[model samples]
Target chain A: MSLDIDAVKNIAHLARIDVSEKDLETYTKDLSNILDMVDQMNAVDVTGVEPLSNALDATQRLRADVVTETNKREALQANAPATEDGVFLVPRVIE
Target chain B: MYSNWETVIGLEIHAQLSTNSKLFSGSSIAYGAEPNTQANEVDLALPGTLPVLNKEVMNLAARLGIALNATINKRSVFERKNYFYPDLPKGYQTSQLELPIVEHGELFISVNGEEKRIGVTRAHLEEDAGKSIHGAAEGCTGIDLNRAGTPLLEIVSEPELSSAAEAVAYMKKLHSLVQYIGICDGNMQEGSFRCDANVSVRPKGQEELGTRAEIKNINSFRFVEKAINYEIERQIDLIEDGGEVVQETRLYDAEKNETRSMRSKEEANDYRYFPCPDLLPVVIDDSFIDAVRGDMPELPDAKKARFVSDFGLSDEDAAQLTNSRPMADYFEAVVADGVEAKMAANWCNGELSAWLNKEEKDVAESPVSAAMLAGMCKRIADNTISNKIAKEVFEGMWNGEGDADAVIDAKGLKQITDTGAIEAMIDEIIANNAGQVEQYRAGKEKVFGFFVGQVMKATQGKANPAQVNQILKQKLAG
Candidate 1:
């Protein structure tokens, strides 16, 4: 239920976030407090109560299978940092 | 490849649902569209956008589960599979993890005439990430998000497959079943249907499973078999060399027909799956399952059984006819179009199949229609053309000459059934082949075929074979 400095660093790396060495201890303490609060909430006993996925007590709304969207590549790609031939460009990722 | 070793393989097959729109968004899911043209805002995972379930996707998934006799989870939850990839714009993939939509299904695969039951662990609904086109740009990867949010049914098989051939048989059976039920298009080259194999090997009598290496994204059936074979051999070699098999992901290179480690995604196991808060738990009822079941076409097994019982076809012929929906329908249509059951089955499974294989075409793509074939078979039934001449007529029909009657008339292929004319021709053939006829009359019974062949040659293979046989026997006795 607690986060250590190395665990925090690993999480930061997985999320692709940069954390200065000085801030690691502080981030660890903050994340540990958040986990503690989550652990405290988990202690509540409600065996018969249903877990709610959304705030509204409703099942997922079903949509008819139909395409309503048209080509708007220009507008959608307007905010992209880099694009080429109507595709978003990023650093080369090889598998 | 070792006799003392046993290979255990499990398959994860992803079948893209044939829908007009993306799984959760209203974007089009058509293949080969211009890059990003169909990437709607919801598929891009824009802030404040929520996903809604496509009713058709659920119906198809449920249809598959019903066909497989799987338990449909009434309340299935969607979870987010967290990962980092250029093609995944949401930073996580919306997939079913803990509460998959279907579970505990089983399918049978036949290898070497022995049926093996393969258990389906579960099937889940998931959204596909976009395409990352490598080498599309200089020093960069180009991402096309049109495929993002596309619906996929990830069917996971239990690790019971013992060899590459068995794995392939299982895959083919599943492939035909999905296409039979109209759930997937099953186009491997286009990525509509893809498979991954988890392979491991152990000593023959050992019970505990060895570490498995997952070969990923094999798109073709051939590639699947080759990849599994290569991986098995690799594992056996590694073990024999006193090395250990690492449980990691590997990629199959079709060019080299080999598999290599893809170490980049080895940590892909740590997906940290959690409930996707945006999509609510989908609840279902018996009525939903019933509706899906009603719309499902007859499965391959049921159709094969019907072919056997109703048409009196042999087990092998029935199986061949029902290998695909279109082929089964084609066979039935031939029978319904006035050809007898056994004749229809013969032409369908024999000559028609040979022509289709030679032309590298599906039964659906055959130039000769079912009705056309039925018409041709009727000629043989009525003694208008012998089966030998019918092949020539069939070839003519396949060449687009016309229907059976037209081809028969054009090629002068009508069977010679007149008793007097055949007798005269037999007399002439006996006159020509005097030595052979003497040998036949002197108790050389096999020379009778020579006389029949000569008579047939004179008639240009148009003589009815039964009449030829009877007359040759009668005339040779004298």
Candidate 2:
């Protein structure tokens, strides 16, 4: 179940990370160690053991079906790396 | 080459819970604030700040499970999903790993008139990370902390759907259920509900499932259906050409209406998921579950059925009424004020909704109140006002002029329903339109309509339609 070194390199590349050569070897070893732990999980007899999904058994609570947020000011602003006066800010390229 | 192929589709939907606070902090869960304004020390994942589970978030997740007809897990624990992202202030995202809030549920979706039950894998609670803004000023990236730490319920569905239509149906059903349960607002435009699908294609009747790829963060039903269809075709082509589908996470490029590879899919262990040490296990008793269920409102399907049986509404009308709770309440309120169910439904779905949409308002903010619309309907029912006059009154009310009765009175829109008055007008029309009267008597019986119109015009358009028709017909015959 160990992830090959090349597969680890492919994963790092796909994730858009610049893993240096030395780090790639380290990651390959670390990831293999992790997958070995998962392999240990395959030995357990879970043929009929129900998979656990939730820790709490309670029902989901409902809120008053009202428009809590009429203004989307903060939600819209949260993603903008730059903003001013309730508007998204960007660099003036032409100026 | 007509060969057999089967497509398997599963969904992971992320819905923002309609809670007022963050899942792990007391900061307001308000959307659209200045960057980092809503963030607290905990939301920022500052040192020494331990995560606290919001009781309301857990309850909301449980309610979604119930609405999906899933089994509520008595014990669900939160685990830290280790990852690195600027948006995720917490270097590790605290999410459900071992136990989720819901399990063993089924979503019954009606696809092309055939009902199919999709398995509910799990629904769990987690906090939304902050957003990253790339390609900002001078090719630099910017990070916004405003949406950081919002509560979201990740609902995962099994790969039960086979076609694009079924996928859309399943998405819509989940959207409607969350809205009905009052857990999530189900606003797709506001990013309240988002869907991602894992799709794979295999040869027909193959017992082994194909390697599925996950499409991430598609915000609309149209995008989901398109993404699934595109992925299915892409996978089929790859298989036909002897290429194997890779297990990876793909991003849906909405602008291009296509999916692009984002990353190779990370296995559960890749994030180093372990039980969060800072947070305690979430505990729930039977009383909590019962209380949450007790607070549950009538779901959409049941409410739609009620609208049909009680209000004598058409299938379309019932569907529209139960689409949103506020709209349904407004419709019922008008009916409660003694308006005919059909008339109330018409006004709500037509004129009222039109006005609301035009003003970007909801039914709760409708200018024409239920009682006012009911009064207008009553006037027409009692023959005190013509349908045309009622429309005029409705317009006046929409302008915030007055109530229906007051508007009608101010506009002098009362109908002339008296038979004698109508008969007098009809006599005048007969005398004035002598040529038409002669033609009516000479076997052209359609001239009776002309006489009725003349009577209406002579009465200044106040003549009761039934009375005017009856008097004109009787006098024309004589």
lDDT of each: 0.91, 0.79
Q: B172-197, model 1: which lDDT tens digit per residue?
A: 99999999988899888789999999
Model 2 docking tier (incorrect/acceptable/medium/high)? incorrect
Please give, for residues B232-304, the per-residue lDDT of candidate 2 as tens digits: 8888888889899988888888788888887554543277677776665666778988888898889888999
Name the runs in model 1 displaced over 4 angstroms: none
Candidate 2 deviant stretches above 4 angstroms: A1-95, B1-7, B111-114, B135-139, B201-211, B229-246, B263-269, B354-361, B434-448, B453-461
Q: Point to the candidate with the largest DockQ.
A: 1
**What's the CA error at residue A72 for candidate 1, in Å?**
1.5
How many Å off is the CA of B53 in candidate 1?
A: 1.2
lDDT of 2 at B179: 79
Docking class of 1: high
Give the lowest summed-lDDT range of ten residues in model 2 chain B: B134-143
Instruction: List, residue by residue over A14-76, the lDDT tens digit for candidate 1.
Output: 778999999998899999999999999999998999877667788888999999999999998
> Fraction of the real A/B interface contacts present in each candidate?
0.91, 0.01
